[model samples]
Target: MKNLTKKIRSKKLESKVDLTAMVSVSFLLIVFFMVTIDLAKPKGIGLGLPDKNPEWDGKIVCGMGMGDRLVTILLDDNNKLVSYQGLLSYPNEKPKTLSYDANGIRKELHNKKRLIQEYYGDTSRGPIVIIKPSKKCNYKNLIDILDEMAVAKIDTYSIINDFTPEESQLLAAN
Candidate 1:
């Protein structure tokens, strides 16, 4: 009963936090990262398939050369067009070895383009090309041929990897 006579004291405490500046700093960091990073895009040539046409039914495409004419090109391991021309369904045509200089594939293409314009008329379309890259061909040669294709201004060309028996025999002979 004597403890009931003691007096008691009480104290109060309060705390406050301002989150505006912290949120602003976080938002600024997000924006900075978004602005600084770059996304990578893939690079290379773009190609499409031709609609089924009977004119190409019996033709066997092959060769090595370039220009605004329908030419066939065979890219060998040595990065050379062992044989190139503007017709399919024909025999090897005696595979012509070529250099990468302006006097080689590029020159051949320019000459063929001139001939086509002269004979077929300028109103005629650009040359179509058929590219056959043998299994022994390397990626660099493929790219080089593609670059040649672009430089040759060939509008309709297909990259076919299949090798005909005659082409195989010719390639073996080389």
Candidate 2:
């Protein structure tokens, strides 16, 4: 007779999940990132600070006279930027307030560059920028000005902390 009760069956179901593919994919992704990504590459403005040579006398010395090519940028509080061509004592151009934007400092730089090239009859010579940050001037302003120098393609720039008496008076007046 057909079995009245179905034969007792014991079925075993495997519930284990295979994670080999997932681990392999994760490993592959890690390797891909390691190969594709640049690691610890330093990125920032390159500054060439002048070395204090024992031979250097206390004078504004360069290949040629810098009086005409000098562009002193004084960073004051409230993001105020004062720039002038030549020395503060006897400026080639009077001190004028300039912004860090394209029309302000950038345009000034470009104009100065063109003027210097024309006057000197040399395309390679650019203005010598002296960046002087006041006591109240924040670090961001300093960085922005430096970035501007880079954007303006200024070759010779000096970040001088020690301001002269005239420069100090100018900043205070501003």
Candidate 3:
């Protein structure tokens, strides 16, 4: 009779060890981690368009080897801003070198932005400025042009180059 009583007491004690609290704590921990974790995302500056292959079907126009409706910025051997068909230029005389001041570049960019809006009606289709620097052009001038591009929020840009097929084939072979 004593053995039976002891067995009953042991069984009751075993059943009383509640696992509900442990399960609740585990669930709370899982939720906390989920809330604190950050979702992985791509890191970089976003561009206006997707990447295109070297042999893309798009036609190459303008002196910069880009399609039509592109803004072309040509730099002569003297490093002067000669003509830009896409962006508006000051009347009478052409500026040799753009000032390094941010405000100056911003003002010019704003004017260009307005012109582009009027021409295309969509500013999001950002104007593609092609930089065609003459062989004898100063390297500093190129840097200035790049700076202006950044200030103007002009992202789509390309450099003009003329490579012979034989040269290209040699490069490919290498």
Candidate 4:
């Protein structure tokens, strides 16, 4: 009788679970993944277009390798793109004139960008572009060419208001 009473008085204990460590570890893992993940960047071309200043001097200032790996694009008021490589003194050949079609400027830009990248892994020493926009070219043509440069992922390009006499003559002939 005494043993039976003792057994009836005893109660079974319940087990407790501690999830604090698990919660902390989960938070740490989340932070680690977030820090390692890479975010998508916006697509746009960053051009080196010089600002117009009143006190400017007239000089044929050329950048490094401007004559060799130079990509010259002349824009007319008619939205025509006259493109070529090397200097304006290349009297032996004429620049290719193309419309602003999908197969036109964009294709040429992509090719030039690829070649420059392949030859020189360092973009700082890659191909340089000279954009000679004639007074005849409308504002839209300028914007479109800039957009094409962005699409091609070119890193180096400039807009020159000063057109050489040789370039002017060549453009006139075209």
Cα deviation in Å at residue 23, candidate 4? 29
Residues 1-174 of candidate 2 have per-residue lDDT tens digits of: 887788888999989999999999999999888866755466677433233345666443453256788899999889999999887777887899999899999899989989988987877777889999988899999999988889889889999888888988887887
Return model 4's CA RMSD, one decimal: 9.4
What's model 4's TM-score? 0.58
Task: Please give the range of 10 consecutive residues that has the lowest summed lDDT in model 1.
Answer: 59-68
Best by TM-score: 2
Cα-based RMSD of candidate 3: 11.0
Off by over 4 Å in 3: 1-68, 86-109, 163-174
Candidate 1 TM-score over all chains jointly: 0.54
- Name the lDDT of candidate 3: 0.56
| Candidate 4 C-alpha lDDT tens digits along 64-162 | 334556888998866777998877676214578888978998887777777766765645555577888999989999999998888877767899988
State the local distance difference test value for candidate 4.
Answer: 0.74
lDDT of 3 at 108: 60
Note the Cα lDDT for every prediction shown: 0.67, 0.83, 0.56, 0.74
TM-score of each: 0.54, 0.62, 0.43, 0.58
Candidate 1 lDDT, 7-86, residue by residue in tens: 88776667779899999999999987876663334456743322333566744333332232556777888766765554
Query: Which portions of model 1 miss their true places by more than 4 Å?
Result: 1-69, 86-94
Worst ten in a row by lDDT for model 3: 87-96
